[model samples]
Target chain A: MRPLDTAYMWDLVPVIASYVPLTLFMAIVAMAAALTLGSALAIVRVLRVPVLDRIVAVFISFFRGTPLLVQLFLFYFGLPQVVPAMTGIDGVTAAIIGLTLHFSAYMAESIRGAILGVDRSQWEAAQSIGMTQGQLLRRIILPQAARTAAPTLMNYFIDMIKSTSLAFTLGVTEMMGAAQKEAAGSFLYLEAFLVVALFYWVIVETLSVGQRRLESSLGKAVAR
Target chain B: MSCQIEITGLVKRFGDNTVLNGIDLCLEPGERVAIIGPSGTGKSTILRCLNWLDKPDQGTIRMGDVTVDAARATKAQILALRRRTGFVFQNYALFANKTARGNITEGLTTVRGWSAEKAQAKADDILTQIGLADRGDSFPAAMSGGQQQRVGIGRAMALDADLMLFDEPTSALDPEWVGEVLDLIRRIADGRQTMLIVTHEMQFAREIADRVVFMEGGRIVEQGPPAQIFGNPQDDRTRAFLRRVG
Candidate 1:
């Protein structure tokens, strides 16, 4: 409020930057796990598998309806309280599980829409060629679905990276935690937080560039 | 196996609407049959039923060595029948993610168990046959409707299926482009490919079909040589249809 301390913010950059890898690790691992499960859930929903689809619907609804912070708390604190054995799960593991469940639920709907968005004709054509269901999905449907879903999926991933900030509350010393500690020690809250904010901006911008490149590459076949 | 298609009691229904009523037909190897009817009369349904795409409510379809019973066709039987048959869709349903060449190679490599190299060679040959040799790398989105349908034909041709089915392939194309696609189909028929085509193109049907079938109300009213059907029709419905369309 009085005066921005440029020097202090600049100095805090490296200290907070060291935790970027831990932040990225949480997001990357969670995203990978979520993408796989989310895609499977989408496929199940598309195929309308009896019983399993209804169960997956309930699972998706619960995860998607709840906040990520609340889910993390439920997994890390509530679960352990209810089941003493769940106490074995450390903070990092709890955070990853929470992220995976929450985002996978959201990503499931987007991916389902993308899969459905693929032209119906593609399915008939693939079937006419006598391709097994697996071959049709792997060779034809998913490839086209990936192109339609990539942009949305990448958005979810970027949101996920930012969401990793909440991991600090789970007692993991990720980027946000590093900044909180730095601010608490030096009483330079503004400088510490601003530096971490810039780190996130840079990371997200780099990813935005990556998303564009990926979209174009996937678009080669349809590109005029 | 040579494509000897024997369809008996083929019936298909959509809820209360029966699309293909009990129909019996037979095709010896390399026979070219064209089905003509109004849009809702299920001319295309017969082709779809043969490949089990529409799943007949009742009937038995025997294509080459594989036979599929509509009431209880297993996954294996359906796939077996489909493998021996090729289908071209009205919408030119080319795989958008694949190039012209890739679309042709897809079934060859995956369904036929051909090596990638072999599939690529086959695809290239088909591309040339379809007169789009230079456009093999082009995607469906960029191609004209004629070119896309030609690629669709090439995709089916590369499979080297015992029987080929075309469902109003030119119905979705611009009038100008229809000729080129019909031309490609004619050339493929020249190779002695057993074909069953459902079409609105009366003249094309007349020119290409060894047997011409007229359908009404989900049933084949009459079928005969192209000369008899066109020059001297048999049934009242067939005569009315030819008059209305011609």
Candidate 2:
């Protein structure tokens, strides 16, 4: 309603920027956790391991089907209520667990699709060389799957960095939480939000360039 | 040090369709056998089954001291079968991510547990043998189909396999490139490499194989020395197949 505070927005940049590392930490930890858990889930689904496969299927479906915010609230607030022992769990840990599970469900399918996208001949060729199931996956299949998954995985990571803002709901003072507190005091909500948005825009653009370089490098052998 | 292969009553079925049915084959040490047949007659399936790529529905396979029963071949037994034999694929399934040298050294370092230096030396020797020493670092995508298959041969060569199974190795090659690959196989044959080849290249088969096997409808119709099968003709089906291909 009032004139936009261009000068104040510039002032708030450092205040918001100071929290960048916290946001990055949450995203990196969650992405790393998700990638590992997601790959495991993918291999389980691919191998179709008996009871374990069905359990993973339900986990993936539940996490993917539910909203991430609801999951975070349920984990951080509702979890401790039901199980008093879990009340000791902190906000950042809860936020990370939520993000990891939520993103891993999505990542499981993409990783699974990439793993299956690898040619059947690769399996035969690896097996023909007397590679064990572990060796075959480690040396042949996963390397190729990593290439196929790099772009999409990077996409998930970038989305994850943006999504870390939701950590504020659980009382984690990440970049978005910092900005919200700043805005609450100043009543310059639009300016503070815009400053935080610019920070995210910069981070995502830098990562997008990185993603392109990664895709190209990973694609070197596959380039035809 | 070629090993003998005794495959008895080998059978394979995909769903309701039978691909390999009651195939019993025996190979003397270092004996090269070529399997020639129509497209869907299970020629490739036999080679794949021997490699344990396709689990046979029924039979027993004995090579060297290791034996595998189709009904219940353990993981270790199947791996043992594969370790003893090398396979050359129709489409040159060279690992796309690996260079020519890397593909050859892969089995050496991983399965055989050789030192990297030793593996590299073996890979280099194979590259020279395959006449692709300069192209050893090239990826499969960079090489021609013939070159890729040669590297495929080199990968098998690195294994020092007792039996080499060629599954239409040159079938996917360009017409111009087929000769070079067949010539390479002939050179391997000249060394008394125990090979079982399934091929459409009748002329190459006759030239390289000690015995030519004719297969039809998931069974071996006739098998004999190249001269007897190709020249003297035993069964109506073999003759018909030879005639049609010719």
Per-residue accuracy of model 1 over A105-170 as CA lDDT, tens digit each: 999999899899998989999999989888898889897787788899999999999999999998
Q: What are the per-residue Cα lDDT tens digits for candidate 2 across B1-246? A: 333899999999999999998999999888999999899999999999999889899999999899999998999899899999999999888887899999999999999999999999989999999999999889988898899999999999899998999999988989989988998899999999899999998998898899999999999999999999999988999889889998
Error of 2 at A184 (Å): 1.5
DockQ values per model: 0.74, 0.77
Candidate 2 residue pairs in backbone clash: none
Tens digits of lDDT, candidate 1, B1-246: 333989999999999999988999999889999999877999988998888889899989997678888999999999989888889999988998889998999998888889999898888888888899999888888899999999998888877788899999999999999999999999888878899999998999999899999999999999999999999997888888889999
For model 1, report the TM-score of its A chain: 0.95
Q: Output the number of the TM-score-best candidate.
A: 2
Model 2 residue B243 lDDT?
A: 93
Worst 10 residues of 2 chain A by lDDT: A215-224
- Using alpha carbons, what is the TM-score of model 2? 0.97
TM-score of chain B of 2: 0.98
